[model samples]
Target: MASNEVVVDGEVVHCIGCGAAVQTIDKNMIGYTPESALKKGLENGEVYCQRCFRLRHYNEIAPVSLSDDDFLKLLTKIASTDSLIVYVVDIFDVNGSMIPGLHRFVGDNPVLLVGNKLDVLPASLKKNKVKDWLRQRANAAGIRPIDVELISAKTNFDIDRLLDQIEKYRKGKDVYVVGVTNVGKSTLINSIVRQSTGIKELITTSRFPGTTLDRIDIPLDDGKLLVDTPGIIQPEQMAHHLVGKELKLVTPQKTIKPKVYQLNPEQTLFFGGVARFDYNSGDKKHGFTVYAENNLYIHRTKLVNADAFYASHVGNLLTPPSEENKTNFPPLEMHEFKTTRKSDVVIEGLGWVTVPADVVVSGWAPKGVSVLIRPAMI
Candidate 1:
């Protein structure tokens, strides 16, 4: 059968289950269903991709890889289309979560920046402050979002407000929701579905051309679509280096409790074997507060002893290279920064340490992972 031809009805159409195009070949590709499944779905008067077939029948998400070509196709479609872009980012790892070069691809579409995992931050942090930070970060990445929203998808906080904002800004056009993996984009959509019609299951009954990417199309009452683009995987995250329990251990689940440490120059703190912070120079003693998952272990030692300590203790005393994964873990690379004002030394995918103005610090992370300074978040 031809790639575009529907074996079922002799007409070209997408999966009624998830809107992906149906293909009888290449199970690795999007919109692929077994010949048997296709016959069954067509006999039932609807065609479903195996991805959605499994989702509907077994409640299993059989993930399909959205290839680079597929992603570029999605981006090109978005650029040519008139829609509201709902770009989601993780507040904890904002810098790592942005889709590279998205601003250029967005064309005339107005972007609404939605920062997820806001509940992971301290309650003392203001929402406006978070939005400002998110805007600054987005702007730095060449995205000037028309508006910014901070919400905790995990807690369902501000989801309704976010939906309202989307409804208002979309203005009867389609809405394209985009994000990197782990930003909780799917969870946010689930919440929206639950609130909109109390339908717990998201059945994509609409039809569009098989775009090659497994884009979920949610029909709007306005005869438009709310497109959920597949999440892109970023390799720069420290998350790429971890597995099993360590990833979960480093990921914050709720409100972060700040841990304050009285510090002087020439002191070093180890954030497991994953990251390190050194108080290299300072005018006086300052208290640095750590904002990371409560479960991650932090070890402090004199800077002079730090080298020898890490050399011996890493992967043992310092973990999450955890011992088994140590050899494969990249060597720690140093990134030094001097704070002109209160700033955060952030280790991407780990967390951050907030320090007072005028402190010279050095952050270390596994090579290729990001460690940088930003204005303090809280």
Candidate 2:
């Protein structure tokens, strides 16, 4: 439901949407509302911070603020509740987006994996292959989802199918949608509202039965609640390291165009200073297909000279530190992997580089962001 009136500090008002304190300043912070909107909501006996108002009316998303401890508390509350967990993740950044130890938090609730932004991948990438890979990754993360559905919220593709999967697995139980930010939860919510059958607005914000934690609920026709939880912010995502303009270069704003390169044993490919791929050892020339945002720069150079090259050219020749951020940019930490089989060296939020078998490579990213290898998807 839209507004759950909760009094805070005896005078301060809290948002019914995600139970955050509402403020009139700093749009980037959680629970921000313009004075006019707040007044109108009060006159109507309802109040929604701009984020919730936009989420409900326009299918738009805004940033939310939460520390790790609070997020863990929320997850703990979720574990004690009886609900079906709809775990959404970015198809592009599954490993980086997963909440560590999620399997332990949901208690007995079965999970449904929703992979959003399939359209961002190339048309040649097989959807079935991607689904299989996603399932494997989810398993590795200790979650055995009841099913996996890959869809593009931007295109409204497979939305009805997603709703059907939710209905099938929910078993007349309440549904809890959860994900880290930028995984397209808001868009998915919009699509579900447009497609799901027998939807009714939830009117009560009473703490979820046994806990003081509150969630925004939309009632399903069957009288079950479909709840929207606050998106947790993962500090390891690349977005936390770069400035706003630099973030655009890494984020897939449109369909990514594949770039393939032939590499030798000591060659390196720099994904703009955002990531580094060093081909430390490989016999003969092998093809490496890059799946990244079209605008991100990929530069190739001899591995021997890579340090000097990056040292001299990080901000300009290699970018995303831009000229202004180079000195303050977090140092990239390297993780090495040797593949016995064809694989994708995924640099989390930044896309992946598909490499041939029997090759040793090292991936580097902003200190906290992860770099790992997964069995090839395509």
Candidate 3:
């Protein structure tokens, strides 16, 4: 089936289900499912998938959600109880994964920061730095986690240790796993269940955000419940802006390579069709490697033509919105970063560039695309 065109901010966004092109009109079909559940056994063809059905029926909430505020409110309700908080974050997109002001609502609750997607980063990155990054991020979010650990929800990496930590901090209290969308909260839960109990009963997982609209509980031996909460989609994230297919491409499938290329001052490097980088003011020549999708195109140009080059050839040569985002894309901003400790200058959902010790560099990506420094994981 083909999708119908719906204009959003003068652009076309696809239907999450059926892949038929969609427009924002006519809630009867493609882009309009209720944000909460509908009555069960209502006579209708299979309009939504089993996931949506489960969300509507079980949770009574169609969780194709909005921003963090809604999610925070949901968390506040959960926090009203004495539950342990498992704050899941994407190790790959750490900055983008955080929910701002999360700590304020989680008062007096023990929080565990579980960094998902360690499998996505290069193995050479230091785990200590990764933990430090999580700590710093947690602090910035006003969260004070009792424990921080890295695990790959897909590969089951360090998941046992994570489970042990959960058991310890939870102290027989219910566990609530929360994160903004696409942070792999569902995958981590599934991995935990399989590892601890070996039960593979299906739980919700999706490439897009807001998959778990309501909480589902899994029993633990300690009289505690590991509850899966819906992932809130942050509007500022690049994931929310991308089409589903494009999102899958940008999502990391394996360990990343810190691909370093040497560039002179005023040289430019393009990251796929998503972002661009220029060595505005550095040493005569600086060596840098971008860690992103292998298929993404990286082209180097003189600094002067960089802006014009991007304006003319963003989706054409540099591409993710494929052809759609050529002019509609957000403006680019340059962020100057000076690294004293080794770090990865992350562009959130985009990719990151590894900087060696004592190196000073400037980075650029689309506006609203976050650029931050963290201790190098590789």
Candidate 4:
């Protein structure tokens, strides 16, 4: 059974190497390998497997990998073009989603900020506040977006509006979609393809950044193209450090329920066994509400056992980076926040802690996980 793999339709697919269900994007587990390699073998007059075929033909661009110079070169094309730029951002990790000099990259081109994953937030949150927060985040990144729209790439929420908006701003020109990795850019584009073109066959998708290293063009009405550009992976992201299965545990699926905790000074909240938040100094016994994946364990423990607990349980209880993560999780870092306005202190992809007004608190998480304060979403 050495050649158990098969060519399915036009793509070469294999039983996911990691033994997980063969999801095309699950890089850690089995089926997620590229299909282009298989395609190469088939074209050579050989019976190639499905995964390799996908890695070959459909993903003719090869594995979504490029040197920094290649990246800058590819991005320069977008920068020099007159196409409309659709910059996608994950609402939960706005700080991490930001491209510091995006304005310079897009150059005089109009940028439309698409805040994705809104379906993960609690139902009680205000949308206006979230929109305002996204506007501010784009401004901070040096991109003056004409409009900001929130959508859920997973659920296809507001995507039609996004398309309509693109059509409106694009003025019959091409539309270029761009974002850093793991912001669901592929998923969103796939959704758009299904709706616009009825093409459901899987294209290049991966949990890892650089999955779509090359620009893909999908035809639009009026001969315009909806181009999908590769997302850049930031070094400081927790997602970059995690294994596929561990990453599945951290990424949010369903809507998030903001878990409110009433805590006295000096108490610690452990997010699963991975990260710890110690309320070092706070007024009115800090009321902290955390929003994260429901499966991730959030525990209130003594500050003393925090380190030992993490050491004893990481990869077992705290899990993420799973057993397959190559890079060791960095040591935890602490950040102190004084809230003049009621805000959410976000732990990048993990979740957010909604701090009640007049509460002074300090939060801690893994070193690269960004802790940002924004107007409460819930």
Candidate 5:
């Protein structure tokens, strides 16, 4: 009856961190421990399913795939509970990271929006302005959180203040931290656990989506719990289309150094074939600054030869999608926008390009990925 025991055949044991059914088979599955390890855990009365074990010990994560229907079912559970919702989002990919219809799921519960990866933004960017932007975007999406806080889980920036804010708003009610995948929810929780309980790296944190399969509850001092939910996997995320190495090439691991490009009316830039930006009808000389992974390859080319260049150099000059995913990679779909004001052309899951006002630009990404223009976040 203890928390760690596996009551053989009577009931299935679940991972303490991810809440997946612990089994000794299928290493590829969500909650898998070897037979010997399972037996040892059963005898010792302490267990972390293999996924959590790797995540804890080796800082590695195994990807688990889930259907949208399954994710919706998980969200539906939160609606029936009287808990405070902490909605975490990636500041870099605001549109792609938002869970559509989240307001419906949380019911009357007050939501707190936590923008993760604030450290990725330019240091010159004002925090209050960023928070205001987040609030406006969240309101437009029907998520009017009681408070909006910004933090970088990777860098531990503003974490202490964020914890204080969460404590104030929670008011002894249970807290549910939810987000779409790759938003740093697990990393944020891991930081909180370390700070609050002195338990180092208690939860699995990874760049992959669905790292936390089911809800994992961490007990708070007030007898309430802070639950970490599985990241809702959005198909529109460019992370889904990329492999490990390819993903690394695109995902920012540290503060980005914005790359500035001087463009003419008919210039094009390719972000490794994953995303492309064409300055179709801009001024003869204008600037486009890209904020993305520091190492992501950016190649400039004439607009007329852009197609031929891409066809010839997809895996070489334009790197990731890396030959392995070339066949599966959807041809870039173009979406044109004429920016009346200074804006960022965001290719969901990839990064954004800040363009000067009154530029006619065409942003492209693989089919199904979102390409939109939004007020510049920088």
Candidate 6:
């Protein structure tokens, strides 16, 4: 046994991954290390705990079963301390990425809004225009950030600029990075860590929610720290209803190749069972451009036969929330929107459909998912 090893009867050790107390029982719980693994780790003076082991070797993520009360308690700690809040958001799913009541928890700290996943947008889109649009949306949500930076953590885009901004705004205080689940907070932190400390894959990351269970701090050059906080699970995000593989189908891994579908009134488009769109009323054929995962299966049908098509094809043709997840899947709810001008009908966490001016369209998603309309982002 090592001199630093402190072994208690019940709680034995802390995981090197996310710094959670490790135990040998409860396979479903956080920081579960097998008894044999713990013994081996103690003998060799190398301990990774089970969660960190799986994340490093298999690239798998385990959900941190944290209650809302527990998560809010963690956020409340930030309010008492002086820190710079780095609020990261998914550029593709802006509405779904917002943390509710965040202003109350951040006190008067200046927040730097980081819009991630910028690589998922179309290449032709202007960067300045997108930044302006994000600023307006964040302001509307009652979040007034000191600066809004657009970056793609997956592609390493504009990371240097973000780091420079952090150095300038942090003013020797600790930086706390926070966001709702699946917003690339871990990915962004990992990138920053790799650049600053030459440490690769320090944190576990995946498309699923709750990969980070507790706060992990990385020391900065000036003795300040960059803290990564656990992501809050928003019930409205489609990621909550989806299985792991189903989530990958909805989350875009690369730049979306916009698929244009020309439709007349009474036509429908099904994005698997995740989302459905109907052109209920329109004067003529309008172009509907879909910005979603490149490999997601899309089917077209008559509006009248849409129900029957979904019923028969859900598990087979329209998969992802496949047959195994059918019981958990909620019945799709309908939301009708009349577009006075060009806009995007966004199915939060899935993707969006750009519709032309003067059209009546209806969007459907599983219950609890958010369906909203916003000015066209492209």
lDDT of 5 by residue, 159-252 (tens): 9999999989988899999999888898899899888878766676766667778788888998999999888888888888887578889888
Clashes of 5: 0
TM-score per candidate:
0.83, 0.83, 0.79, 0.81, 0.92, 0.93
Candidate maximizing lDDT: 6
lDDT of 3 by residue, 187-207 (tens): 888788788778552465667
List, residue by residue over 19-40, the lDDT tens digit for candidate 6. Answer: 5566676787777788899888
Model 2 Cα lDDT, one tens digit per residue, 1-378? 224333444666766555566777778776678889888877775777777676556655454455667766776778887889999898877866798888667888999999998889988889889889889888987889889999997788998888888888888999988887667775677567656643322221110111112356777898888887766667787766776478778888788888889998999999998899988997888999999989998999999999999999999999988999888888989999999999999999899999988999999998988898888877
lDDT values, one for every candidate: 0.79, 0.78, 0.70, 0.70, 0.85, 0.85
For model 4, residues 1-378, the per-residue Cα lDDT tens digits are 223335467454323211112233444333343456445534654332234345435542234224656555667678778889999998877878887678767888998899999998888878888899789877876778999999987788998998889888999778888888778887888889878878653345655555655566667878878887767777666676665466667778799766778888767787764566776665557677788988777778666676677677666666664654524777778888877788877788788787777666666767877876777766
- Candidate 4, position 300, lDDT: 82
Candidate 6's C-alpha lDDT?
Answer: 0.85
lDDT of 6 at 196: 81
- For model 3, the stretches where C-alpha displacement exceeds 4 angstroms are 1-70, 325-328, 338-343, 356-360, 374-378
Residue 112 CA displacement from its true place in model 4, Å: 0.9
Q: Rank the candidates by lDDT, best first.
A: 6, 5, 1, 2, 4, 3
lDDT score, residue 228, model 5? 90
Query: Any runs in candidate 5 off by more than 4 Å, and if so which?
Result: 1-5, 8-12, 25-29, 42-46, 54-66
Listed per candidate, the RMSD to the true structure in angstroms reads 4.8, 5.9, 8.6, 7.1, 2.8, 3.2
- Give the Cα-based TM-score of candidate 1 against the true structure: 0.83
lDDT of 1 by residue, 154-256 (tens): 7889999999999999999999888776677766786787788786645431111112245777788889998877666667767767765667667886688
